[model samples]
Target: MPGWLEVVIRSFVSLVILFTVSKIFIRKSFTQVTYFEFVCGIVIGAILALGSINLQIPIAYPIMGLLIWGFIPYFMGWLSIKSETFRNLAYGRGIPIIKDGKVLEDNMKQQRYSSDELLKQLRSKNVFQVADVEFAVLETSGDISVLLKKDYQPVTPKDMGIKVAPIKEPETVIMDGKILDEPLATIGKNRQWLEMELEKIGVAIENVYLGQVDSYGQLTVDLFDDKLKVPSPQQLPLLLANIKKCQADLEAFALQTNNPTAKAMYEKNADEMMVVLEKVEPYLKQ
Candidate 1:
């Protein structure tokens, strides 16, 4: 065989072997890979490259090298899962770098993590001030996890004792101006309903670049033409306003009525409407 032809054949074989070996290994993002795994990847790629171009060396040698590099780590990973000691040895435990708003100099020194490095990592987590950090941990993957002090943390609805409806993932009913029937069905809607919604907004189906129907049965659309402004869906907000108006009218009727029984009935109905508004305001406001 000619030299180029042999190289091509060898390269193809190497590619297949490398892909198979990679499939056998645990899947992890580049940032999440352990130190040993990183080294193994580098060595495997080197072997594959050498085997692909160097015609003098037998392809079997590189194949053997790839298997050794791949299987050893795979076996070690299995062992790590079964034994905590081995797991710690393979991938070290997370160290607490910050506790009670104070940086632990001793632990930082043990990890050989410098002050500037710590600050840089903290900044990456959007924490500019060390005093605001209640706890910070350095993971084996070299990523920092931070928790802000209660006073520094953003207040959630639960913190204010307000109940909110659980949000579900929105279904994409249209993509690239094409209607998707399955997603429409998933949201318990049909093509005719979608058409009616688009008509209400004065937007044609073909003009929509993407459309998603959220859990509250609101259809939000992005038009293909960025310059063209599409009005937002006012179904929820309009319903809310109408309910408020009804409640206000009831209150007014209660005050205007001279009959004691009628006044009591208006006041009771107004109070009930107020409760209903409170329950639905969160869903509608969004």
Candidate 2:
């Protein structure tokens, strides 16, 4: 057999075996695939890849290694399910990163996670401050799960015993080359009314891929191949006003305290904000 042909044949067989073994042992869960499992997957793949390309290593050795590696996790998974102690030992339980609004700095140091990194994670979840989090845990997969205190959590209308407006589902008005008459009738609109709206957007009814009319009588239509990029709304005036107001407040606070560091910091930030505003004005004019 040719050398290239051997590689192709071995690669095909290795992939088939790898996928088969993976399907048997790997139970994917989106919550947290533990660090051990992730590393194991990578190592197993590397072993198979080496087995496929290297002519020196016997194919049987890699095949056996795959089985052994796969078996360990499969057995561990069973043991984890059957015993709580073993489960915790195999996949470490969540560690508290924050409790009672105070950051567990020592625990963070042990985990090698930085304060800035924690703040970034919190910000990603729409939490701007440490005081807002009641309990934050770091899962074994290196993900931060946060639970906010009741006061900080978003309050629903049901909590206040107040009724909210009924949810109105948008109905399809035009799809493909067909117009949906029933949905239009339910929203008290006809094809002629839909046509007029489509005309304003310079799109014809037959060319509309999808069209919807909401309960509020708002119409949204999409042409079959319209890919024009919409410009974002300009906000130079509002941003400039807010930045100036904040700078004034910071300067007043700095003067009252007479702290040299605070005064310098305020001056620096104010200067930077002015520079940003000046740069943004030309773009807004366009």
Candidate 3:
């Protein structure tokens, strides 16, 4: 048999066998891949080619080797869906990176993620500091899920005894210093109506940063230069008192066990209250 012809036949046979084996064996137990499986794929491809073409070197069997290499992970993904153990085996179980609002340094080192990396992830979730997290889980995909300290989270209508309403997308009336005529039309408005509303707020169209119409057709105006100043030293004591009062109220609410959802809400709020205390560090001592 010609060497070239033998290589061609071996390549074809290797592809068929690799695809068949990958489909049958590899696709059942893994959602994520591990380092060991990757290396095994290369070795398996080489052996299959060696037996088929009687190749002296792996380079002579490049085409089939590459095909088999890609098949391993693809096949493993199929298997992983059907079996939980295989999925867990390929991807490590979720680990706790944070518990009870404290950093788990040991877990961080085990995962080989730096404090800086963890902090950055926290920041993306609008958590500026570590003290704002109640629990953090490092998932199998290396992503983290964060539960915010309750006080720091926005108040749901239910928290304030306000009736919960379905979420509705707000329509933009203006963006980038230009009136969104089409969106305004969709909300049954024209440019003239927007200008009149801007005048009512003592703002010109150019001065508005953003303006949106909610489902109730209520116009909410946001200004570009809106800046909230930190409370003066004289105001700090009052602010702290307000926060403490809120915390106590939440604790009391949580004690009302008749309503499970309200209890959980108050409990979560109580946890968040601690975060608020930590945030106003200077006021605490004073």
Candidate 4:
């Protein structure tokens, strides 16, 4: 083929290839655009532009070039997930829009998001009033996670009349074939304590998938031999009652404390209690 003709042909082929590859990766707009995907799009676009004019190379060379450009973004993304520093660098740090039930105007300015834009996202999520939000975090991907105020939240079954059992967060007994020490220390227990607790339920440490102390000071165990089971309605009431009583006691204690530390801790606990109650409402019976 003639030199000029070959170059033109390569150029046309490059255009077709670039479009096809970009469509494969970029998929949809307004979706979470990861750092890797964004970088891939740019690099592929640039390489295709280069390959179009470089007719001296074989077609195989251009195809290989496209592959390399494509995978660079994918590799970076995989790395980001494995490394916290890389993930932060790729996605950017979360910015706070609201703190302590107040809007941070300075943060909004820094993010270059106006009041209208913030309100638009909020309304899209059906959150109309700013007073309803306690803390709104602007995620790196431009998404917002809102923490709502107590009174503005939905009421739970506990609030209406249903009793709930105390269900504590399951402790990580083993992660990747290793026992976690941090949880052990937090609960003021050790390996010996865990082993004895397991024995009480006729389970071995290896046989137990997860075993932890519930908020009510009861050891809850999940055995590898058994399939998963949801708590009965009867059990839920106990858990709910435990949570409510603890919260009431905490609020009462906070009201009585004069120390700044106690006051701050109490307020923080109150906010968490409100959030939990709101989240569990759907499961509760009025």
- Of the candidates shown, which would achieve the greatest TM-score relative to the real structure? 1
Of candidates 2 and 1, the better by lDDT: 1
The list of candidate 3 runs beyond 4 A from truth reads 1-63, 161-286
Regions of model 2 farther than 4 Å from truth: 29-31, 162-286
Worst 10 residues of 1 by lDDT: 21-30
Q: Give the lDDT ranking, best first.
A: 1, 2, 3, 4
Worst 10 residues of 2 by lDDT: 228-237
The whole-model lDDT of each prediction reads 0.92, 0.79, 0.73, 0.73
Residues 90-184 of candidate 1: C-alpha lDDT, one tens digit per residue: 88899999999999999999999999999999888788999999999999988899999999999999999987878999999999999999999
TM-score of each: 0.89, 0.56, 0.39, 0.44
**Residue pairs clashing, model 3:** 27-75, 27-78, 27-79, 28-79, 28-80, 29-79, 29-80, 30-80, 150-272, 151-272
Q: Write the per-residue lDDT of candidate 3 for residues 51-129, one digit (tens) a residue.
A: 6666666544554565566666666677777888997887668889998889999999998988888988888888887
Superposed Cα deviation of residue 254, candidate 4 (Å)? 52
Question: What digit string (tens of lDDT, one per residue) describes model 4 on residues 120-194?
Answer: 999988899898898899987788998888887789967787656545575565543357889887777788877
For residues 72-110, write the lDDT of model 2, one tens digit per residue.
888888999999999999887888999999999999999
Ranked by lDDT, the better of candidates 2 and 4 is 2
